[model samples]
Target: MTRNNYAPYITISREEWAKRSDDPMLHLLNDFETLQGLNEPLTMEEITQIYVPLSRLLNLYVSGAQRLHAATNSFLGSQFLKVPFIIGIAGSVAVGKSTTARVLQRLLSAWPNHPKVDLVTTDGFLYPNKVLEQKGIMNRKGFPESYDIRRLIQFLANVKSAKERVSAPVYSHLEYDILPNELKWIESPDIVIVEGVNVLQVRPRQQQKEPTIFVSDFFDFSIFVDAEMEDLQQWYIDRFKSLRQTAFRNPESYFHRYAHLSDKESEVIATNIWNEINRPNLELNILPTRFRASLILEKGGHHFVQSLKLRRI
Candidate 1:
């Protein structure tokens, strides 16, 4: 495929990017299996070839941000607290973003200068089932309107301002809802990763006049995991099948009923969900923000990152 010459990003083959890094940090490979998401393949070779260099690049950005912070403090002649460097990871569901975020958290934290890297997913910010039902948007669960946007912005603002303690609502995949009175507390971290499908999305202008902020406003760097539409649809269906055998089998799981369906029946339901819900969200909401990312990880058919795109500064 020919490069889009007018694009703001510099596209490079994975091999070309891998040439810049020689240190694989192989000791970290042991954690890969645990961190990887279902149906996501993350071999040590892939980590060394792709993520090693990516980690180095992130470290550079973190260092530069810290330097700029210190310089700004000096210029103002005021002692300002150091805020965490925030990275936003965005992509469609079942595109391996969770694995990417977890891998980055592990790799970035390995750096001695930034030992306290914390990861949080935007799933926590999604509105509860009751709230969605009240709004009559239960079918649009992953859509932008299904989120508590104002609260998400406030949470990021607190993180960017270096708040002593910031808390986020906890979401449970098994329960498929927000857990009441459960919160994830984040202390002062050197870096914070906010991962979700809609992290790169810009709010619709019709929603509010003169909106003050967006979820991405606080991101120092952002990444979009990209793949062909067909690949994503297939992955989503495959993931559903896998979950039916695993999490969906749990008596308390919200999707427990799905486990009882025949293989063909499950496939039909999964395909319908993908075509009606997830596919439209990807086309209308998520993919539009792909170019807005600082970097894009373009995946091939086997879910391997085939290329990298870094937005020109």
Candidate 2:
């Protein structure tokens, strides 16, 4: 197919734009100053200029999903019960994927038709660091093997199947591990947002026997937060420093020792950590998954998404 033929078919009519202009969800996009963890929040003008279109775009996708369900129900017989629509958000570390997930969750939840929306991050699916250490894979924490793929797959399966109650392990940032016996529970919702660095990563089917059930397999829609490599490097460094000062200062924090470093020392540590750990994980495990997302949000150094590219259905 030619490039044009392969492009995403985004249907944004004037009527839709008019409706979105007055959408209440567009209001939530205003109160937040900047993407979360940024030094400052975005201005109202910036929010309007950037996210108004994005909110409308997401609304269109959600509406389309409902129509698709109706069509499927017609084929399967009218006795069908609707299941939650799951959206996956994936990107490299510090590219603002968390912020994107939160924005979409807030906006999607505001929809009167789908107010029961919920969000779950895949960080909770990672194997505890102790487990990774036992496997001698502590240095590969964010790599695909570091995650409990089976547990993650089962969790998504349950969510997609409309199970009465679903639970996910909780990962502790301060402790830098998955908290034992801590879980987040969810009831059926109109929509669910699953966010992570490798949510869109693809793996080969096992022995070509059964369909692969990688995390992306359960998504009805997916988003990738994208930015220039240099910009992401800087953003990672900035967030790392902020965390070192704040979260790392906690006596029980896994990274507490780094909190007392001098500014110059901290910068060096941040740069090394980014280059050796975060950058490689992004390149080897996360960046390759961008093409698999339903939409790609490209950001500028200012942290505002400058452009959005949606995949062809």
Candidate 3:
């Protein structure tokens, strides 16, 4: 069967993309042990074949953006503050987006022109557990509504405006809640990467007419990780099991109870969570925004990126 055409996006196989360069930077996979996600085995081959080219492409965009800024400043006869180039990465839960963000952060920072790079997740913008409980949306924690949309928008606005010493609330994965009085300071960075499931979501209707701003509006480029739903479900379950063996085993872990369960019992719980919560969010909220991405990394089984779809200039 022939694959469907993704118009306006040039799709290329992994092998073809690999041939673009043979630079040593492309084969820097020694850090894979730290960058790989739970239950996700990212190989050096994949990095050289897939992510290296992606980093180079982003470098070009960053360079172009810098040149444009310089030209605009010259035309206006004013030296405006340099705004950071922001990249947004969106995907379903357990789709290895965090790993992708981390890898890109490392790669982008290594570039001489943009040595100062930072990464922040929308998880930090999520409503506190107390707030979610008060709103009766605790179970829908990763949904769009579960975030403090106004604060998130403001945070991005500050960053894009070149505001100094901007800080965001910090969230603890182990406690599964926002930490009071804790902040992640974001100084002026050459590049900032924002990763989340809902980064590509459209602005809410109430603000649609009023200077319309979205989290994505601040993004100079965006990426969406893609995979078959069945594959994603399996990956989610696998990650859950791996966490149970590690992080979830901690007594303070929000999911500590699952750590002691038998393999079959844990599998049942993971499956139910995926089917009841994650799958619905992906179908209704996340997957719908995939077409909005500047690039789509289509992964096959075993977390291997098989093809890439890049929007045509």
Candidate 4:
């Protein structure tokens, strides 16, 4: 059965909210510390306070998946039962899904068994800006309809089918578009993290109406990053400001026009874009998929995940 077609099932949990400390999982995360980009890497307090616990929890999920795979293999008596564990990470734009995916990919790969992890982002499937402009969907960039959903689904299907080589388009944030003819290839990986604003979103129509395949259908696990709308808006504006000073200043950047704006002007433009475009897409398409994820990482104003709501077993 396809992942999405399965009935809603919960992972067996050892406790309501399991906490971990000083697990071997931390050793696998050595490279992940560099990715975090925090100054004074490997501070004793940081390890005890954060990575140790998160990695431990992830280790549990990985262990559980291995057991399931073993069981399925025994039942089928097939040697071809192996496949990369597929994960879906979804959230509104600027809600820090990228960071979460990066961290998870690095930490998860630290395990001795699954040393190869790959991350594929849905932004790669977004229609080129020129196409969106021609289609009058420039304002609907993050909406479900703005993506090449069929191709995205096919890509996931290819990966899940264990294709020897799979290629995907690449997106450029500075250009704010999908670069034509640019692609990233995956020969094989132990794990694949597919992250995007709508990674878990189903097509708008019901199955009986059109029977479409969603990109989310291939996930073994899914995560939704959520925060208060107000907090999200603030975060979006903050990120936009940072981008303006960095990416937008690049001569080849599509958003170079914003580089000349005054700070106040930039803030105004950012807020307007968020309200008229991003917020609407999040409300109409993305946020609605929260219930579809295996876990919800709810963040606070500080951009830290304050609570995790895992599906009840």
Best candidate according to TM-score: 1
Which of the two, 1 or 4, has more TM-score?
Answer: 1
The CA lDDT at 33 in model 1 is 89
lDDT of 3 by residue, 1-313 (tens): 9998757899999889888744667545576779988898877777778878888889999999999999999999999998999999999999999989988998788776888999999998999999999999998989999998889989999999999879988889999999988999999899999999999999476736566678899999999999999999999988888999999999999999889888898889999999999999999999999999999999998798999999998
Task: Sort every candidate by lDDT, greatest first.
Answer: 1, 3, 2, 4
RMSD of each: 2.7, 3.5, 3.0, 5.4
Candidate 2 lDDT over 128-166, as tens digits, reads 988999999998888888999889999999988889799
Question: Which of 1 and 4 is the better model by lDDT?
Answer: 1
Q: What 10-residue stretch in candidate 3 is worst by lDDT?
A: 21-30
Against the unseen true structure, what C-alpha lDDT does each candidate score? 0.92, 0.79, 0.90, 0.78
Model 2 bad stretches (over 4 Å): 1-23, 29-35, 38-40, 74-76, 205-210
Q: What's the number of clashes in each of the models?
A: 0, 5, 0, 0
The digit string of per-residue lDDT tens for model 4 on 48-80 reads 445455556666777788788888888888767
Best by lDDT: 1
Q: Candidate 4 at 241: error in angstroms?
A: 1.3
List where candidate 4 sits over 4 angstroms from the true fold. Answer: 1-18, 23-52, 206-210
